[model samples]
Target: MTSQIELKSGTAMAPADPVLRDFRNFLFLVWKHLNLPEPTDVQYDLAAYLQKGPKRSVIEAFRGVGKSWVTSAFVCWLLLNNPQLNIMVVSAAKDRADAFSTFTKRLIAEMPILEHLKPGKGQRDSNIAFDVGPAGASQSPSVKSVGITGQLTGSRADVIIADDVESLNNAMTSTMRDLLSERIKEFDAVLKPGGRVIYLGTPQTEMSIYNRLPERGYEIRIWPARIPADPDKYQGRLAPFVMRMIQDGKGPGTPVDPKRFHDLDLLEREASYGRSGFALQFMLDTSLSDQDRYPLKFRDLMVTSLDPRMAPVKLMWASDPDKRLDIPMVGLQGDAYHRPMWMAPEMAEYTGCVMAIDPSGRGKDETAYAIVKHLNGWLYVVASGGFKDGYGEATLKGLALLAKQHGANKIIVEANFGDGMFTQLLKPVVSRIHAVEIEEVKHNQQKERRICDTLEPVMNQHRLVFDQAVIEHDHKGTSEPIRQLMYQMSRITRDRGSLAKDDRLDVLAMAVGYWAESMARDTDKAHEEHLESLRDKAYEDFIELVHRNTNSGYEIDEPSWLN
Candidate 1:
């Protein structure tokens, strides 16, 4: 077939044969044949990266960038250049992979320049697997499609195109994300020597698998819909071409591809997908987005050393320059623990102490506990930890000893699991160790919402405080960061199961909720009530002195001046 393209304007032009060798030229010819508009600047840049990028690379572009279409055309260019090379397309689902292959096959069949590479007789011709006409006999087809979880043992490929393999459904929980990570490892075994693997997708969460691929020696390049104001968030991961544009004075909110997504269009999309969603999907930013989505802030809680028996009568919270703690923080960006700015000189005994337990059986879950003390109008977290031993004797006795050591007046156990069996088992242990009152509490509302509702307000008011030792203990006690209390507090959202393991945060929420009524009392009103009680006691003592004198043998006499 001649490398000539006929334009819609009823004219024919034949370019040099070497022009077709460039993937960008090939893409232009394909677009003309499909009667689509001319390729945008960003699309041309994408084509350039596909041709000259590293062997193992990732392409993270915003939605509606037409990345898949450009890639499909590039696949045709690859076969036109070398028909013997085998390629594989993988996705989270089988149908998506098939669609990619189908589009590539259609391009080869319909385009005149690619007519020589069309599948011939006695060759695999289906969409799932197909071979080019000029390819020699081989064990693998010229192009094949499969899901990430499908059979990938015996196949081999020179190029692997992973198209949106990390979807929201497959990467919701830690276990599911782990399984997906393991499953994708099959690509290494299926890859031939000196092969290339390309990943194309947006991140689903802050812990996205795409973010971890860089540690394995894969070079990543990201292109957002607009130039980012905070380029530091990308950590120099932005495409060199994009960085150049930014250096050339392209301000933030300026559309990277004005032909496709203009300012008005992007604004509409931003409104459609809230700020967080737009940040994740369009901007490819996870950290700043999560800071907006998650309600709890680590800096809101006052961190200080506290005596279990007594606490300051009044404390003030501030986020001024000197109030920020220098401790390690795992919360979102710009979030850090803060110490109180001021504290009263007077100290008083705690009103009550309560222990809350989030019970769990065996397996990956843990039975978490927290001890909280209530004062005038504030709550203090003193102790918290998790027991992986489940309902075993060690776990029960450990919990009993913790309550006894903390001088807890009541123990509240979450009865969601095992139908109150954990509470019953704990009763015998507590009877022997501390003899504290145990109460079973059942919850019908969603766990994430409940925890956030119970904690966000108190944290916002700076009424919740954490002992410095508790923060240190929580950080060092667990090998898995997800099980840590501070981790749970900083990462939870209102969405159900937003946290993989929330037992630690759940118990903390329950303990804080125990003093909800007391927290409702205004600080000034409580002080006034205390003073009124002191005055009533003084009046009663004066009356008692006069009555005692009247009952005595000697009668009470008036002052000499009065006589």
Candidate 2:
């Protein structure tokens, strides 16, 4: 029964018994059997965690760390050690779970030492569910693969392996994350007494379920692709060994497992995934402090009382303490609204005012609208709010009133929702109330990407200003902060469904987008032009004064003293 492994230098003797007793040894054997290189330090560490960690545990290693592969080998080791154990594999999708179980089954079938545990005749042997040869008759198969939302109830297991169960698709919004949280709670019901549940995943968001499992008594360990510069972002969540390595002077940007992924490989991945994305998937840092993750910041906005028809000819933005406005803020930490550092004494009428509408049907979404005014390369948000009445007469009337109240001359309605039907329904109401021209616009890019692209640059330049009244109104407009315009604007990422309710932000982006062409004007250039115009006016005034003082009515020549 002994297995002999032929190495380049000599013959290495494997265990004679099918059960190796050590999961790490089993994993190494599997890797060697597959003609793969020797197991890396991180892989061995993951194997050790699988074997000796808490009964309820989470393994949050970076993507491409071979966590799933190591766990599959651990599964084989577990079954070889105890054939009567019933195991379940769950994932965000059924296909993923099936793949996990399929790999486990393939290992048991192909590996000579594990051949004894293969399903015998008259036993369930499909990839979705199967029974081991020595497993006793039970209601559940020895091994079962099911999706998180699949039929999980009524099935009992001695061990559950939830692999990649929290993906961007399932855990995108608060509601989706809540549903996923509740779904995993069923694991407590399905698991037998003293049973173990192991979760293998890379966090998809800051509010990832893996991050919260520790509160529920499940011990968690995280292994990032590279040593973290800010280890506090992990909040002592790194694996004990990894933390020791960090304390041992292992600096940031050093690959924890260079054999698998070198510095250049990780850099390439970082470039492909983007910094924030790489932080989530590879660095395993979900801290929202990363500025690049959420590009829009409340600090970037100038908050002041904006006139519906007039604004200062020149406004300058500053983030100094004196410029920071003491307002109710729902943005990320250290993000606060700021007032403009300077405003011209003379005010001029706005060049144009536009309103944007993101219409939504009766549901959790809101029929949001925003009114923005443009003047001298700056865009001002005068009014913004949402209606829950959908396309009803009350909602249409509310929108029309907002346009008239804000002196909006043009209304832009998103055509993606109702295919111009919402615009058509609103035209008649607007004609009776405001008589503003309504235009239907459609977007082809992803919603989050489009919103970020349309607003990030404008906000970055501090050209997008929010009315102090609009900020106050938005805070009081909705009981739920996620539906508020500022909250949505500050929290939105490039990921799809990053925000549960983006209606308010969408309309704001649309309103700002209408002035995108005018936004290209350089603020510095505008200031220089203003200074030049002021100099020209002063010179003209001086000439007029000298002409009035002169005895002759003819133009006076330049004096040498004046020059």
Candidate 3:
């Protein structure tokens, strides 16, 4: 039973002047006639943003959110309301771009109210390109479709829409990404002045092209599937905040369209794709969805949930790999140096401990440090933390106190930035607090590669142990230094595409390198001690033998004394 207000079938086509004036009314009409579901809040927001069109608007909504459908309808609405207006649709591939124009063509042909906007049979009519009632004032086609990577040297449009411009297969690598980015720049030359630019897609990478649109004065609107959890802190207008919301359980409580995505539906999707896939496809979280790229996972890390502060040495490995790292490893790849695999303490005493520091010294970057203990063939982490505070006296003094508390023998400082400025600055602080040997070290290998090479072997053998504090971190983007550290650890890429800085990783790698060097030194020292002990024992045994022989009344010793 159709509503009484619904347009009757076979009715004479007439322009609804009122709807022509109001875009929302036009959308309501389209939805009503198309039998589409009622618009959600996000859908309405999309309409409002598109209404402002001809500026730059990016629709970073989740998959199955009807962004393409809505954009197609908007294109139909644009042409119906003003036949003279020129529009173009672009996508990652020609097939997707054709879909946009095809849908628009259908809307114009089927909608009775826009009978006047139908394409002239002799004028121009096709799936990829169509003209509405011929070109009088503006010769450019009323609607055109082209792939972003396709040739478009002679095309022009008053309004250019880039829909799903990036796909996983097409834009996965940096080379493909650069080509796509550079190709899109041609839109500037082709677009008429004051023309509208609308982009619709979910970002596949952290360095998404959509992420850079704002810098060019393009207004961006991101409508994820779920409402952002710190609604005030995160306005649901970007993918970064979407990651935060999901990380902190801020959203997916209620979906945009409850009928389409109920709680059970969302839960099922979550189970199917796991955290990474669900985050990328549904939550629109580009930053959170990449777990496969990192060399390490939290599951791989050997961690004790029991707080170290409360339960000191509750966990120990035999041979005290916690303190000494020179415990000869049996299996090693490459140079085959003995790298100790630490264990729960059946018995052992660790021999050496070192601290490594990466001083960002404020300006929004973290000043991070790591303390590690080495046994004969094993390594154990003592403590790790970072601060945002600048290299102030308090920050320096606090670090000095932490190093002393950890009983670290040597502190290695990354001397990349200020040429030992951080180490020199720490000297004054440590000289006043408690004197500790600090060595300035420079890195020749890049941070990510060094970390991967050094830590991968250690972690692969299950040698490294993490404190509860680092293990228990929530890893929310808003939580700052701690979460940032975990995100970098789990999210950093071989390409280094996801993260901007890795202070925590840098310092931890330095600490691992320091301990590796100590492994050799400690082995030498132990060998020297063992040799001295043997010499002393031999001397004592000889004396005892001489005493025994003299006390036994044997005169052979007198001949030796005379000689």
Candidate 4:
């Protein structure tokens, strides 16, 4: 369609051809001219956005959609409308770049309306580099195809099209991602003034370059298989691709391309891809990746507040009777710890308790500990926190105090860091202060594996309960103490950068493992020892002996200590 309209000066001037001027119209004309299926609503909307021309933009559409075809049409529309505009097409590799150019060149050659805009009569006619018109003395190819790693410096473009630059293999590792990002930066140097930089690809990772480009001033447009109903919650957050979808009047949860994608097809794809893969491929929900990697869930842990007055058993630290001053005895603060499982509403008779420790040598690293109790097969997360004094005097005394307060007879410290010195240094300090026992444990398993293997089963069965007070205190997950410990447990990933340290998490896992293993390790011994204690009590029955010797007060059979 040649555009020629009469001018006001009685001379004829060509108007921007109607078909080439509006991108949507250009798409419709091209689709009609080639005798192809009409573009979907999403396809047309994508073409419209690119036509509007944002300085920098990201087009993340679901795979199999005709986004690339529409983009190819848009390139043709631009060259036809602005004949001299230089364009560079970039992809993950040379072959992919050639494919884009091949399709584009095919479109121009096959369409009758685009015949005049074909490659030069005597100049370059290759798919990689082609001309829009006959070659001139000062002519360079109007379109150039280059891989992201290929030569990008010697040429300049009025528009740089980066199509699918992120590949799965390149995005899996941090180093590869950095290399891709650096390679993509060359477009900036080669772009002419005021030209638009367009990026089109599916995001491969949570930290993919597609997700990070917005920080550098690229406007991103995401088209997922389905658009969420309420999008206000996702204003600034990038992943999940939740946005106010305008193409279809259909509400959220409905397919963006209802005509092409069926309900069963989508569900089958989701099941086939699994959670993480489905999120990355279709739903555009990367948030599910952490849930899949992190074994602990926020929902698995029970939350409850405790009051000291309601405590069934209390331990008090009192001034020695030999002291003359009137210092008052301080009872256990129940609110600090002691969260019984929700299933067991009331506190039960506890058979064993231990405090597990992961000690640090420097104040910068935390020395974390957890006091766990075992009743039957049930375990209680009594209390957990960190001491910043490392393995010094304060750390030793702190563990002793915590053990006494929680009535825990055993304090198990990780021997890996200090080479068994953690418990050795605490032995004299705890013996001099209280009768609490300190034990050393040499960890032979990976820290992450240790935590997941021990804690996953117990948590899944709802046998572990955590203190709600501590969670509330660190609601934002900021501190590196026990409060932050729970946060780490809920987000500990196999990926390196996700969690740099797991000291507190290690202590918590060790504590849970202590009681979990005790059910197997000490079941028989514990039962025999418990029965032996009862037998020992029978011989020292002061009340029965006292009653029998009521008539002979001085000859009572009561133990000398009691007397």
Candidate 5:
């Protein structure tokens, strides 16, 4: 005669197995039934902890490592085995939450010994609490699963597991970021006091919740898989973590070769994704591999001033393949310590200059034109605008006006893309405007590669100065351009030419190319202008020095010196 002994979720644990009697023993027993091996160092640590420690009682592992399976089993064992303990599981996304719930349901069904514990509800359904315990236990524990983003305001949890708190693939997008921030904030508020949280995810950004978990006082666990102790070994740590995890469930088997744990052959076969898959999945360092994100570090281009008072400079305009205008063209005019200063209205009287324009015709984007002069320092950025009707005619007209107004000596424009239209459509309408003579040429390099190859020396030598006005135009201008430049600078050369994210960076590279061409030209105009300004300022500074010298009784070798 089989007696019906209902478990919390209403499945009957007929014949009352003793191993399924308690949470800890149930976890161990079910692992055996599922044919999983025993736990490893991490697994043992997790299974033992409901208390604070240096190692996160709550932990995160990288993707594709079966984190969900282990965690789900852990939660179930806690609830079904203990009559007094309730467990709550949360995931960053709906899919992940659903997955956790599904895993728990599957574990219940697969082990007939624990099959009586199954909650009669569907798998992946959230907010369902199952009364899981032996009948007449005085109290029964409840296990509930829910999305982290759901309405968690008034809810309570005993043990919360948050999985994949931020979206990895779409972290950089603005819309995605807003959603993630809300999720993090809500998760922080939900867990009950003394209730523990186990957060899991790959580190996608420095600002991501997984990375910021330490700030909230959650202990951290970092596992970098693909990075070999040495460059040659090439084996990853994923295999080791998995082996340990599986071992914890069953019992330790033959010790795994750390190298053979992660399938090198499977990864190697897919060559293009080798670095990313290994770095993100195995190592769990998101910032190191996320190429599309902005680089927080600053790269110094030029150390010189833009003011003629400091140093005069020639200016050139470079247009890239996209013919984007309004892109910044930077120049250095003074030493590193001094920095370029814009010519004040008073100082503009003595400056003469040439102008360059990067023209874009009939596009939604703006047209960029610069009037540059050599004063005490280099001062460019004459004027910028969107083309009327998005046509080149307006740009050419503006260029003519800028040249005449600024007394420009020469105009340089790339005739590669419909630039000849300027001469035909614009020259006839405007006087004193001609297409600058330069032949268009194509190169074999990709945009990212070209920028890396050419801009490295310029950046290292401090020869390029990004315009402050342009770089800080807005968040869009600042974050996007800087993000691309860093990707180019950190070129993944050995990996056959792949850098993280680099679209807008090509515009910045065009600006660099313009500066290189301009600096190479005859500096006679800029040099002469610089000297004149120097002479004018030298007299006043010399007089001040002389007055101080005389008053302080420091010997002044006036006519005594050069005189």
Candidate 6:
């Protein structure tokens, strides 16, 4: 058990038992036999409050205020008065819960008046538990202590007690937050109406279970550093002990020391996690921005694998001109939003899909292409590479062969450099490739503007996950193309200077266009039955026209374009 100190102020404190006869015996044990001193102002107040009906309350205070000692006495009072009543105690973690339970048992064993109750006896080993006269005591609370494990298993009790729930060391994640929410729900279901819930913890986060509970209609009472203050004469003596304890927990560390502690001795310094710890614990503020689009939220760009056995491959198609750099064409795969799954050839049957390519002319800056594939409702990178001598006839042949191996069926190439040259160059490669179909596409607008317009909805829906290494591939830790795209989006109208060049964003745009086209095809297929009805009507019309000319065998003419 962690060491605890009891302040012996030498004033007479009230006894644990409420009845006059029992109270006298309890006091005799404390003062004469145990030689313990009186309680402090905080302990006295808590004792008085508990004497009322069994209403549960919370205590939010600064650290080192003897919260544990005060709470311990309260529990003892309850147990002695009503032995059959069950109490549930929980903490942020299993170890902490066990510590609190152990401390309570120690307090019971040390007090002489209650020693006859034989509170610690049942364990085959030493003193983990206590029992009273013959196992069937006329007076015993039947108190049992357990951790919060398995779904709400230990939550049923006439009283529920929770200690410091948020720790800087064991910070809460979204999943953790969800688990806490579930436990609270169980409390609501199992707690008998009018039963009490005592929540005692130092505030850690703004959205902590403490602050959130009151919004759901739990009566809230605040104990700030000072009850009232006047700025003119104030020396800030309020909460002096609490502030001193917070400083002491820092353990003689300087600001430069990477390991500094905050209030509650549990809060840690915030770095890359943003102001999450500080905002949630001491300041008590909630997040106002959408986390998905947060500029610095790295997890927003992360994707994780739901299954451990499954691995997924990343395929990318993009055009780059300067493929000459040693690392110009590096493709990385890791968890961006989900845990990463490494995909082998066998898993391709479930995850394998086609990748579209866009060829470049100069390949001077770098050859560029775009690739997109759907996995678990998200489009992920498959493969992307750039080269100095961009794809022409020979390079196209190599690319097509690689695509065929990956089971890709379509390759869309831009014909803007010159349709004649493109067709001539691609004709031989297309003839040689039977697995993939090649199509030439032409464009006359600014590539950046067009791609951004098409991809805006995709970004909004979080339908795409990109490689973080690739996004921040440059030295400055910023993706230039993405920055430009964001700049363009801010302007409702394109009325200004030349927009930023966005090679990567262009590839993303093409992928979005392809996805949109596929959705349109599905919609058309959904109405195929109605189209079938129209087809029969047209066939009947054609028969009528042919029958009218049957007598003369009217000369038929092919369409002008075909002729």
In the range 94-141, model 2's lDDT, one tens digit per residue, is: 999999999999988888777778899989999989999988888999
lDDT of every model, 2 decimals: 0.87, 0.86, 0.67, 0.68, 0.47, 0.45
Q: Which stretches of candidate 5 lie over 4 Å from their true place?
A: 1-27, 40-42, 45-58, 62-64, 81-86, 109-141, 205-208, 226-272, 287-297, 300-308, 312-462, 466-563
lDDT of 6: 0.45
Q: Each prediction's TM-score against the native? A: 0.85, 0.71, 0.54, 0.57, 0.51, 0.39
> Sort by TM-score, best first: what order?
1, 2, 4, 3, 5, 6
Give the winner by TM-score. Answer: 1
- Which ranges in model 3 have alpha carbons more than 4 Å from their true place? 1-8, 11-16, 134-139, 230-252, 290-563
Q: In terms of TM-score, which candidate is stronger, 2 or 6?
A: 2
Residue range 221-311, candidate 4, lDDT tens digits: 7777876555542344332323445443657677877777777788888888886787778766555554455566544544445432232
Shift in Å, residue 436, candidate 2: 5.4
Clashes of each: 0, 0, 25, 1, 44, 50
lDDT of 1 by residue, 1-563 (tens): 12453334432223235666678888888888888888899999999999999999999999999999999998888888888899999999999999999999998888767777878999999999999999999889999999988987677999999999999888776657778899888999989999999999998766688988988889889999999989888978898888999999999989998999999999999999988888888899887656656889987899999997899877889888688888767786678898999987767788899999998878658999999998889899999999989999999999999999989999999998889999999999999999989998988999889999999999999999899999998888877888899988887888776777788999999999989999997866665565566556766775676689878865655435323
Better of 4 and 5 by TM-score: 4
Model 5 C-alpha lDDT per residue in residues 13-37, reported as the tens digit of each score: 5434553443344445555566666
TM-score of 2: 0.71
Q: Could you say which candidate leads in lDDT?
A: 1
* Reference-based TM-score, model 1: 0.85
1 against 4, candidate with superior TM-score: 1
